[model samples]
Structures are given as C-alpha cells and as structure tokens.
Target: MQQYNSLRADYKFTEEEAKILKDLQPRMEELADQFIDEFYDYIWGFGQTAQFLKNKDIIAHHRKKIKEWFINLFCGKYDMPYFMYLYKIGEIHVKIGLPTHYVNSAFTFVRTFVLNSIEVHFHNKEQHLKEINAVEKIIDMNLDVLTSSYREEELSKFLSLSSFEKTILSGLKKFNSYVNLFLAGALALVAFFAIGLFVYDIYLLFFSDIGIEKGILTVLGSLLVLWAAIELIHEEINHLQGKGFAIGAFIMLAMAALIRKVLIYSLSSEKVDDLLIIGFVIVSLAIAYWLVGVKKKANSV
Candidate 1:
C-alpha cells in the first residue's frame, strides 16, 4: 500500500493487473535468467555502460541479481518494503553519478523486451492487451518512483551547487579560468604549509611548552583556525573541479571554531559580556541555519 500510495496513485494499479502479473510469474521465472543474459550482453556491448562494470566477476553475479529482482517485480506483493528497496537502488545510482537519461533509456529497453515477449506468447488480442497493459503500468510505476529518487538526489546536489556557484561568482569572477586555477593551486600550497605548522604547533604545546596553559590554548586555537582555512581550501578545490558546494559543511566548521574558542579560553575567561556574546552568536547561527532550511523548502515548493 505504501508503494501503491507513492507510485500507483499515478498508474492506478488494480488487483486485476496484479493478478495478471502474478499469473505470469512462472513464465517470468523461466525466462528471467536468459533474458537478463541477453540484456546484459547488449549493455556490455556498449562502452558507456561497460565501463561501470570494471570487475569481470561481478558481471555474472549482478546478472543473477537482476534476474531475481526482475522476477520478483511480478511477485504480486509490491509494498512499502519493496519501495524502500528500489529507493536504495536509486540512491546507489545517484551515488555512483549515473546519468538519469541512462536510467530512462535502460527502462525503455527492458519494457520493450518484456512487452514484445508478452505479445509473442499470448494468443487472444484482448487478453494480450490486458496483460501487456498490466506490465506497462507496473514498469511505469517503477520508473516514476525510481526517477523521483533521482530527482531528490539531484535537488540536494543543486542546493549545494548554488552555494559554490555564489562563492565562485563573488570572488573568482575577475579571474579567468587559468588565473582561478593558479590561485587555487597557490592557496592549496599555503593550506598544506598551514597544516604543517599546525602539526609543529602540536609539538611545541606538548614538549616545548608543557605546563603553560595559555600557550596550549594559543596553539590549540591556531590549529583550529588552520583547520578552518583547510576546509575553505578544499571548497575552493571542489569549485575548480566543478563539484557541488556543501554549504552545511561550512556551518559545521563555524561551529567547530566556536567550540574551540570556548574550550581554549572563553570557558575560563572572566569577561561575562564576552561569554554572553558568544552564547548569542551561537544561538543566532542555529536560528539562521533553521531559517535557511525552511526558506529552501519554500523555494523548492
């Protein structure tokens, strides 16, 4: 019913269609492995998809898995758990950066194979129409739900990219692509040295400046600042490489800096106003993050 509500609402899947599918289960079981072999042979013939199946061992293994999955689709038991499983499949595709167009095109191939097989097997035109319609509806339902997962994943990437886009437009606009690349390389080198300094500061704190609590605080705070810069440098690298920005990552970095400040000095400092201001800033940042989420949701709608 979960799958029904989420996907079948569009397809109008009925118990009759479900029964037709289940009745074909035996034939599907018989043909699945053979069909999948032929299907994959076609896919493997193409360089674009064969590249993803780099491992030879997984080729047969995944073929078997796809056969099983394909047969189970006609098991007449589609539900929330089934939807969840398909959702995970979609997420894996997104995680691997599979293009959505490839997903749609692959579904078309499967749909044609199954529908043509049905047409050949059934004798009565009306019965053939009925059964094929059931198959077509179910395939479409699967596509709808699966593609929705892809869309959700793309939306997330889009949101993160918007942040990176803003940063690139703000600072890198004056520089050509080559100059931007040069600046990123230069900053990356600086970040590497800063990390080295951070490591050296650690040596100073423990061995060279033992028992000096303020010295330890200074060293710790410096390390934290360097880490923050390193985070920005990574963002810059991703920008240059045309990757999406993770805006929330920066928020976490900011929170880390605040926590470090409080840990190293603010907690023990005698200034009440300073502590109050820090508290206020933390609260404001939390509120701001929440508001951004709300606004993003609104904008998406």
Candidate 2:
C-alpha cells in the first residue's frame, strides 16, 4: 500500500467521461474474456510481451478482466456513484497485488484492442473508418483516466490514508496561520528582509573574509521567498481549480523557509543571527501548515 501511494504523485481528473468509465468498469469486467482473447492475440504478436506471457493461466486471468478497465474509457458522467465502481476495481487489483510493470504492459494490449477493433469494424467503409479514427483519438486521450481509476480501485485503502493525512495537515495549517498572525508576523517579516541581507553576507564572506567559498545560499534563499509568493498567488491564475496549485504552494512555502534557515546561520552578524532565530520560529509555524492543509475545504451546502 505504501509502495502504491509512493508511485502516485497526486494527479486528478475532471472529465465526465472519466466518471462514466468508473461506473461502467464492473460491467466491463464481466466482458473481460472477449477483450482477453483479442488482447492475447495482439500481445503474442509482440516478442517482448510474449516472453512475459509464459504463464498461460496468469495471462488468461488478467486478460479476462483487463478488458473491463479498457471499456471504462468510454463511460461518461463522473460522480460519487461512478467513483464507487472505480474504488471497487482498484480493490480487486490490490487484492491480487498487481505488479506495476504489468499495469503499464497491459495498456499495450488495450491499444491493440482498440486499433484492431476499429480496423475490423470499419475496414470496408472509408467514411466509417475516418469517424472511428477520430473517436479513437479521443479514447487515447482517456487512457490515463482508465489507468488511474484502475490503480485507485486496486488501492482503495489509499483514500483513507490520504484522508487522514489531509485531516492532520489541515488542522496544522489552520493552527499555524493563527500563530503566524500573532507571534510570527514579525518573524516572517524579518525572514523576508533577510533575503537581501543574506546576499550581502554571501558577497562579504567570499571577498572580504578568509576566502570561504559561499555557495549560492543567498540565491537559494531568495528563490524560496519567490516560491512562497508564487504559492500564495497561484490560485488566482485562470482555469486552475486549485488542486495542483494548492499542493505546489505548500511545498514551495516549506522549501522557501528551509532555505532561508540555512542562510540565516551562514551569516556572521549577531543582529543577523537574532533575526534568523526569529525567522526560524516563523519557519517552524509555516512548516506546521501541512498538518491542516491536506483536506479539501468543505463546500457550503
């Protein structure tokens, strides 16, 4: 489970077609045999896949059900009910401990299935072939959706883990925000100012002091500040529903503060050290943000 979670790097889907696929997956699973036979023939033609199919029973089993996931690409309408099917399919994969490599290889079978099906269905009709080609292009766009749904369904417990992480992160973010408003506002301000100060320190340390090689610690510090600013402003960008932006924001802010901390101690001034200590306090508060920021904000009913 941990391994699966680690493989997924927080992607999302918003298309109604993805929802449709989710809902229709179980029914498609029932038609797995039809898909399997076609897919096996297709895979057997490929030397690489043929080598992997040495175990006939195992190959047959996956072929029978992988088709369920294939047809799911054509299902439209995304909603909670549809997600239930996605979740179920994911559980099935998990129960069987499906290998990640096989998941990728299985897509090759799907592509062949789709192309072969279209080719055979419209071989004699040029007009039908053209139409089918266009539709197949759209289906290709949805390949990722089917893959994600299947993987998610296979790892159903991940939803719970994500939910728990989100809950803890949200509470932490909220509490940090309040603390920042009170005890860390000055600290944040000092850290902000320290960006320039660190740059000066870097210049002085290398040229004026005992020839210590100063890394781009100052530049890194500035970058962190810029990153945090970007996070705070990312949602205002048009057409961004705030999922990727939100996660990016959290990561940038944390990184900015961490880089700033490294800069603070690198300086020689007592005054700078004092400011850095304060900045550290603020950074600590900011880092705590992950605790509360994981969960999605509740929509008003």
Candidate 3:
C-alpha cells in the first residue's frame, strides 16, 4: 500500500497532464455512466450468476449498488484519501473471491471508453496529442497497479492442491469466478438504482409536493441498499472466515436502520422504536456467527 502511494506521489500529474484531465473529465463521466449501465447485462449473461438471479429482489438490490459506485468515482475527489479508500475496495473485492480476469475486463472496458472519448474530444487538435497519450498512460498505469494489488492478495492464499486436486480446484474456481462476477455486477446495479431514487426524492422535496410518498419510497430504497450491503458483507465473510468482520457489518446495518427510522419519525412527531430493529439485527447476527462461524471452525478439525 505504501509502495502504491509512493508511485502516485512521484508520478503526480504535470501541468500538461492536468490539461488532459480537464479535457477528459466530462467524457469520463459519460463513459462511466454507460459502463455502469451495461455492467449487469454482461454479468447476468453468464449462467453461473443466473443461479443467484433466481431471487428477483436480490437482483434488483444489486443493480442499485452498482449505480452508486459509478457516481462516486466521478465526484471529483481523487486525492490520497480517495486512493486509500480504493485500496480497501480492492482488498474487499479480493476477499470476496472476485477473479482478476473480471477486474481486468471491467477496467479494460472503462479504458477503451475513455480513450475513444478522448479521440472524439480532441478530434483535430494535433497540438495536445502528446498530452492525451501521457494522460491515458497515467490512467492505465494507475489501474494496472490497482489490479496488480488485488491479484497479488488473491493469489497469495494457499490452495493446497495436488496435480489431480488442481484439476478439480480449477473447475471449481471457474464456476465460483462466474458466480462472484455476476454478484458483483448485480450489486452495482442495485446501488445505482438506489442512488437515483435517492436523488429524485430529494429533488421532489423542493420542487414538488410529493414529500410523503417520496419519503416513504426513499426509506424503502435505503433499507434495500442496506440489506444488499449486508448480503455482500456476508458473502465476503463466508469467503474469508472472518466472523468478527461479519459482526461489525451487522452492527453497521443495525445502526443505519436505527438512524433512518429516527429521521423518518422526526417529521411525524412520533417516537421511533429503534430498539426492536437494533435488537433484532444484533441477535440475528450473533446467532449467524455462532452457527456459521464458530461451528464451521470447530468442524474443520
């Protein structure tokens, strides 16, 4: 991680590079939006993911999250803190059994989009051609480092397979990769939809008289987003065998539910019964830890 920062620190964008960035921001945003839009279509196209897509509600939840992910990247805050945040994202994706190939493919699609957009943006401007190439190289290099970090962590784990076992493991890995890829894509879609609803609800608040209906819809969307997040966290925990992380995830979900309820009831002049949601989330998560985490560890012996 420190090495990654050092690479970025020494390779900061120059003035000419900054010009390329300025020229590309809008086009980048547009491409990012389309990349997110088509993510699900690609993911669901695979049969492995279709297994999880059996649950319509879960599928919808996943689509919403994907949208939020794309929007966040385009928010114009690519500082050190943002980079560190991305590092954790890479770590989490690896922990969840995401394949390096899919990550590579996803980024390749993004890079192609941006490069083509740049070609169109600077159609006849031969003067800044060198700067465009430099900027594209920087972006590609940065993404390469990110992908490398994720792959390194993923491949670092010992699978403990013999030649015969390797064949079985490879087949299993192929299936699992498809499953996680689809799951990741579906999750992105759900997050995106939720974000769209959230923004639209906010807009209606000031411009229209749909507060009550919009508030209800917003609360529902928020719950769906939180639920989808917990499901993703659970999947990651299952992969990593980290009950503690799963516990923390449930706690965060409980807190989110409580906070949302509090805000919802605030406008109604009614008392919010947060205790039930908190207690339920805690008890359920604790039971899950005992059943899945502790039991699995004990049985492994």
TM-score of each predicted structure versus truth: 0.52, 0.31, 0.41
Report the CA-based lDDT of candidate 2 relative to the real structure.
Answer: 0.54
Candidate with maximal lDDT: 1
Q: Model 3 clash tally? A: 18
Model 3 worst lDDT window (10 residues) = 242-251
TM-score of 2: 0.31
* Candidate 3 lDDT by residue in tens digits, 1-301: 5666565446664556555565556666666657666776666544356544467797777666556554444444455675666666667656665666666666665556555666765646674576466556565544656576676664554354476777888889899767766765765565576567567666766677768664765556476555756575566546445233344444444455555554555554344455456456656766665676665465333
**lDDT: the better of candidates 2 and 3:** 3
Superposed model 2: Cα runs more than 4 Å off:
1-123, 126-223, 235-248, 269-301
Q: Using alpha carbons, what is the TM-score of model 1? A: 0.52
2 or 3, greater by TM-score: 3
Q: In model 3, what is the error at residue 135, expressed in angstroms?
A: 5.1
Q: Report the number of the highest-TM-score candidate.
A: 1
Across 85-140, the per-residue lDDT of candidate 1 in tens digits comes to 77777787787777777778778878988887897797998989989889998888
How large an RMSD does model 3 have? 22.1
Which stretches of model 3 miss by more than 4 angstroms?
9-15, 30-32, 45-77, 127-131, 151-301
